[model samples]
Target: MKRIAVVGGGISGVTAAWQLARERAAGRAVEWVLYEAGARLGGTVETERRSGFVMECGPDSWVTEKPWARELAAELGLEDEVVASNDAIRRTYLLWGGRLVALPGAMRMMVPVDLEAIADSPLFSEDARRAYMQEPERAAELKATALPEGRDESVASFVRRHFGDEVTRTVAAPLLAGVFGGDVETLSVRAVMEPFVRLEQQYGSLILALRERATKVKGPKKSVFTTLKSGLGTFVEAMQREIPPQMVRLREPVEAIARIGGRWQLKSSRGAEEFDAVFVATPAHVTRRLLEPLDAEAAELVKLEASSAVVAALAFDAERARGMEIPEGFGYLVPPQTAGEDSLLACTFVNQKFGHRAPEGGVLLRAFFGNRAAGTLMAASDEEVISRAREQMALALGELPQPTHALVRRWPFSLPQYAVGHLDRMRALEERVARLPGLRLLGNAYYGVGLPGLMHEARKAAEEALG
Candidate 1:
């Protein structure tokens, strides 16, 4: 049997192991061993049940449009367990000038093609609106050469150039902050939000591209995001169950890796193991530490930049929640420029948006904190964070009542920031890693920092390892 070792037990690592197992079962004689540094297998993907609330420590849902995660779930017999967002109450908010204002409808993140919605939104000032209207007439100039023959300009530069400063501050900054937990000024447009950037490049204008897109799709619009019926952790747990217990090692942190005698030798705190192939699925930082001796350049590239984040969950009585007057919708996102006293990047109305997230007459609210501009918030004590969250909840939802239960999860350097020129760095790393025949790296740092994107990398890594 060809011995293979999979390092890091996160979703990426577990999924890669499962895929490799399936391939091995199909006539390839392979022995697989999966190692997780942490006690639990699910890395950042975690779900905690406190009182009657289901609190998601990391990401809550995966983008369904990106099919890798969903496809993997189905292959694992979790198709019936899938759940979609509550479209009936699908709405988001923006914190503008110390106030939580409803984000305009038909506006996906920062791309605003709906003039009617933009005109009606209270989030923007008259001057901001006037400036936004002049976007179509703005002169188009190539800021930098495309990364891969046709892509160029960072997300910040793109928004500033096309939509003006108001749009970048009011719309783009918050969206990017929420998604990447990074500063908009440094994020790469092509690396992070390439789809919208591509649309603008193709059509010459965002508004024009959106209108053309709306005209092409002739059916009832579908919600863009989704999760599992039980929770996203269900998917992770299922994958864990599929892998053989003997082959899986939890609470085993890998200390280092080296190429020994044409085979990879993995050293963990417990002991050392040699394998014919190795897949490193930890975060870029952890991956860097493990690969430092094997490849210095690869390690350096993985240590580029990352952001800290904190997710707080607050539970309140449903009656008290209803009285708070939170508008009917999913949640809200606060643009960095306008965030004030009780400023938060985004708030998820868990109970209202997902069923069974809370018990009867109880509401669950999740608030996200920390980004490049708001890193101090990540270091604040839980009491301070909760107090600030309650203040914002009272102002935005009018629910000043004390929370029935509260939970906070802090992630320092949890999110990798894909800044300008990140794609070039990743491409160079990939080319370098390709030179090592049996070595592979898979994680949010390479492709995207979302569930689907991570799953995609896992599947690709598994296929490559098996081949």
Candidate 2:
């Protein structure tokens, strides 16, 4: 029998192990063990249910365009549980000058497909609006100046080149911050914003590319995001059922891994074990530590900086919700310039964003603190976190009634910042890993951060390992 070891039990590790289990069931003569340092398997992908609210403690949903997560959900017999974000009234607000300003409709990130929508918007000043109008005319110039293939730049430079400084600061900063918990000045344009980069390469002007694509594509659009009806917790639960309980080693932290002759050796709390193949799926920092002794160059490649996040979820009952005024949009984002210590990086009006998240009359609000703010609050008590979140939300939206239930979750160094030239670094890392036989690295740290991308990578890693 072929023995394989999966270290760390985040979504990526779980997915890899689940695939191995399927291979075993199909008579592949394989046996595998999943080692998770934490007692729970899901890592940050957790959900809490109380008083009819399906509250997500971490990531709420996956982008719908990526089909890997949806495919996995279907395979797990959760097709019916899959739900789409409510896009009909889909609106996202930006906190500007102590007011909520709706992002213009028909936008792909900082690029606007409908120029008329932003022409008079308060979010952009007269000069910024003019920059939007002049982009298409400057398409030829932009195309001429587009970086050659394989070269990289920061997201700030890319957005500023097309939209000018004001739009990049006002619109792109908070928007990208909400998604990546990263600063545009440091994040890789080629790594994190690949689609926009491709658009730049092909059409020069992103606005033109989006506009032309909109005309060519003919179909009803899928919702921007997708999730399970009950909560993402259900997805994790279903995945756990596929793997035997005995095969999962919870609370068994892998101390180190070494190459032993033709096989791999994992030293954990239960002592050392040899495996035919091994998947290192821990966080970037942990993975770096484990690999340093075995392959220093590979370890250096995995040494990416990461950001933390804090989530405070407040659920208000129907009666209390009725007395408060909530906006119709999904939620709002706070730019760094306008944010203070107690300010939120972003907030999601859970009930409005998706159905089945809250009971008919109840309201579910989630406040997020990202990057440095999250680092500062990592040691804070739950009460301190909740109080600050509530105070910030009340300041942004309005006076809020007391919540029926509230909870706080802290994820330290969860989001890995894809620095400029990240792809080049990852390529070198992959080459170094390939030199070591029967080894694969799978996680958000290598490729993409979203669930769908991780799912695809995990499945592929399992196939390659067994093959």
Candidate 3:
């Protein structure tokens, strides 16, 4: 039997192992093992509940548009447990001009799907709204324009060009920051927002393309996000259930995978072991260390990537929170210009988002801080992070009583920033690794950071490896 080793126990690593197991169960001649430096199986996907309040250490849910996550749930017998978001009260707020401005009812990642609604909405000035109305024609005119050769631009540049500076600063920046935890000015457009780029390239304008796509849809609208009733941790547990016992080694740190005797050898604290194949799903920074000994140049590219974040969850009595009169909304994102240097990135009304987040009469609030500026916030003491969160909440909502309890989860070097021309960089790294047979790269840093993207990439890597 061929023995394969999977490095990192996060969603991607676990999913890769699961796919390989499926191959083995089908009578394939292969055996696989998973290694994790940490004791936990979920990586950052942690959910803790106490006193009827649930706290998500990592992501709360996965978007249903990405089918890999949903399909995995059914494969694990968790489809029934997958609960959709409470659509009855769906709302999101954008913090602009020192106020929690409700986002237009129909908006997609700062794109105003409904121009008339946006024109009437207070999120943009009249002049800005007028500029937006003219974007389709302007973008059509600019369609003949081509991207500069061998280089990628930033999200800030794309948003400013298609929309305007006002939209970039006031709306897109904050919402994007919540996802990347890095500066949009440096993040890559091709890597981060490729779909938008494709829309522009294919139809000559994103606005027109969106309008055309909307007219062609034939089914009733479905919820975009879903999570297990017990929380996303349940999904992790479900996946873990499929993995064989003794195959997963918790707290076993893998130091490197180097070519030895035409086979890959894993060097770790537990000593060296050989495997027919290997998969890397850890953070890019850690991936760098492991790859350095094999290909110094390729490892350097991984070293260039970095990510970090902090999530603070505050629990409060529902009646007391209601007294503060915080408006009804899903959550709010703080624009960088308005948020200043020391503020948070975003806040989620966890209790309002999903009914099961809190007990029948309690409230749970989540404050997210990401990237370098927010990385400093992550490095701060837990009490200090919570204190900052409290101050931010006070500014957003009226003053309220102290939280009954709080939990702070730190994810160091967690979210990867796809820097300008990141796809090119990734391609170069893939070429280098391809020379090493049976070795594959799979992680959130490359294709996407969402749960579904990770699973999708994991499945692809496993299929390729097993074949």
Which one is best on lDDT?
2
State the lDDT at 181 in candidate 2: 90
The per-model lDDT (C-alpha) reads 0.78, 0.91, 0.82
**Ten-residue region with minimum lDDT total, candidate 1:** 139-148
Global local distance difference test of model 3: 0.82
Ranking by TM-score: 2, 3, 1
**Angstrom error at residue 374, model 3:** 3.2
RMSD of 3: 1.9
Error of 2 at 453 (Å): 0.5
Worst 10 residues of 2 by lDDT: 335-344
Reference-based lDDT, residue 320, model 1 = 57
Per-prediction TM-score, please?
Answer: 0.92, 0.99, 0.95
Candidate 1 C-alpha error for residue 404, in Å: 2.6
Residue-wise C-alpha lDDT for candidate 3, range 184-279, written one tens digit per residue: 788898888888887767776667778888889888877868888788888778778777878999999898788888888998888999998889
Candidate 2 clashes between residue pairs 3 or more apart in a chain or in different chains: none
Q: Write the number of the candidate with greater lDDT, choosing between 2 and 3.
A: 2
Model 1 lDDT at residue 410: 81
Model 3: CA > 4 A from native: 146-151, 319-322
lDDT of 2: 0.91
For residues 1-467, what per-residue lDDT tens digits would candidate 2 score against the true structure?
A: 99999999999999999999888889898999999999999888899999899989999999999999999999999999999999988988998888898999888888889999998588988999999999999999999999789899999999999999999998888988898899999999999889888888899999999999999988898899999999998877998998999999999999999998888999998899999999999999999999999899999999999999999999998988997788898999998778876678899999999999988899999999997779878999998998888888987789888889999999988999999999999999989998988888988897899999998999998888778
